[model samples]
Target chain A: MNESNSPRLDRQDLGKIALVSLRAARMIMESGGRAQVIAKSAQTVACGLGAEFLGLRIGYASLAISLGDDANMITRMVVVGRHGVNHRLDQAVRRVVQRITTERMTPGEVEVELDRIAQTTPKHPPLFVAAATGLACAGFGRLLGVDWLAFVPILLASTLGQHARHYLLGKQMNPCVAAAMVAFGCALISSQGAKLAGSDTVNLAMIASCLLLVPGVPATNAQTDIMDGHPTMGSARAVSVLMIMIFATAGIWLAGAILGVHP
Target chain B: MIEAVEHLAHQAFFGGVAAAGFGILFNFGTRDLLWCFAAGAIALGLRTLGLDAGWSLEAASFVAAACLSVCVAGFLHPRLDPAPDMIALTGCIPMVPGAFLAQAILGLFALTSPNPDKEITTVVLSVEYLLRVAFTICAIGTGLAVPLHILKLMNFRGSAAE
Candidate 1:
């Protein structure tokens, strides 16, 4: 009983886990893995500790992982999914602190769990997506002779709005929101660009460039994984992310179509 | 000599920025940045000297960057806390086929005089670009891991000798 009572984690162990997890997250992103992989991976790692998987959800650009023990004790980990200058850092710190204090675990153990959790969390592509979109929009805006600065706000609004919509509607509602925001943003920027530059060039450039912002590259990565011999895990991840992307694309296209914005 | 240096320098700077952007996007470290820059410089110099075989130049540069990054990082270790992701990501970014993707998409959407051959070629080019990016990434990763292991061995040996 006394042996069992020993602390489950120490500070050093936590640090190691954090380091490992951070590295893992880095690897997953670099390797083009999906976001769900992170949560799934973390769950796998946490299984050793007898933590039960509850569910994972993305809320306003944050990912929440729910866990429960066999005895019904519950805990939820809310992690900053994307890299943001202010809010993300704050949330990450808060989650880390909460995990340490609430679990009655030592700093080391907490770090380990946090690290594992971070590692297991899939790569956040939305941040990059936003940045890329911003760049593409700016370039297109310039081509169209519109004020490039205007697109910046649109980008930020769409990114933030998408996150809010995701949280409210859950995963199922993501595609619609993604599609609408993208289409609306693109059309607004393009129309404004056309007016300013008095040239259709800007609209054409923006429309074409925006294609680069699609999630197809990573979808291809998922396909590559299956081709390269990680079928079961690859297929599971591939199908899930593909569905999300499809929905997002559909949403954006729908908005464009409804707005009567044609290429 | 001056013209060559100027050209190499130009490539290095642009390559460095591209590489650095890739690093940040992928979460690499400062050491990766340094190594990537150095590798880019060296690769640009090599290419200037007329070693134009695509795979050879790419492979060599990647290996050079990985090895250099590991050595520098290992030597600096605790002090530098070099972010490997940054270096690796940036190092390869310059080589990614952005142009190919653009061409492919443009060909697919061209409304007038749609040429099937042009579209096919563009598509093939895009596919090739993707494969090349993947290969370079894998090669660089291996290059990084191997040298670090070697450095660890040397560190252990030196300590034992002392």
Candidate 2:
């Protein structure tokens, strides 16, 4: 849309547009979208709002973007909270930008639409997530050449750990703390598999059960961000992932120390 | 030869199932989950095949990750563009070095023992395990990024930098 021909949205409208767009970009970043995609979506909104200049600075846990015209400039900073990779939400935000440009929706309409997207509920409940955790780890155990005997323990321990983690997260517990606690429980349960008289590698079951807690997305994005010239943000995320790994292992070690399981 | 393919298929299926778990946790839609599963299965199966063919662990891991990035960016990106990274990121979850990480920490517990012999064994073993963990983690990062870097070089903005 031509700037001269476009319907003139008020300053208030532009402000609302910027805020909504910032929230959307923050949502994307916190949901595991990389720096490139985050910039693309935010730029879409800024330009859509008829901004003549866009300046974006992405950080470890926050992002700042300034959108301005010849006379008016609005810069907004968004704090990126805990990341939970939800592709569906990320797609919703992207689709919103596409809709704004194609439909020329007013900022009010855009805000309402974003609010609707935010209100959309998760399709899977916590119970389903817990069960999927068990299933995922069982699949891991199988790939590791764990037989059915050991697989049973992996499945059970993972399910138990997933439930505990789910409950803790629901209570707004720190993720690393939840991870450590869940790993302890998982290891304790899996140690029973070690006691079972079998030739199976019992340690495999214990380790596999904790696979669900590994921060795979963070690790991947950290590398991408660093390679893409966002070293500070990327390394921060990398350190976070490394810390989560250590916390998870510490939990397992604590379990072993208490349970007396050699493996 | 047929047996190898069949075994590969089986391994991939497990990898898919494992990746699907992450798909679930990540709140990927059902369609995205299926695609993520396939990409993960293929990448992991390829890595295992390379291992069976006598490739080094790091080499196999890096190759698998590169394949995963390619599959996600090239094949899945167009279909799932706006959110391309989601599929590959979750798919690689199963391949993270969970076992080696745990062993590295477990090995650290050996530090408390008073016996000098036990401490020496612990130090050597822990170092070896931590080194492997470091390599595997590096393998995952480099593996996944290299393909994306190539695409960026080619100016293919399907998923990233578009």
If you assessed candidate 2 against the hidden native complex, which CAPRI class would it receive? medium
Going through the candidates in order, state the TM-score of chain A alone for each one.
0.41, 0.91
DockQ of 2: 0.60
Candidate that scores best on DockQ: 2
Q: How many steric clashes does model 2 contain? A: 0
Maximum-TM-score candidate = 2
What lDDT, from 0 to 1, does candidate 1 have?
0.41
Predicted candidate 2 versus true structure: per-residue lDDT over A142-203, tens digit per residue: 88777777777787889889889878987999988998999888987876864573627676
RMSD of 1: 10.4
Best by lDDT: 2
lDDT of 1 at B134: 47
CAPRI quality level assigned to candidate 1 from its DockQ score: incorrect
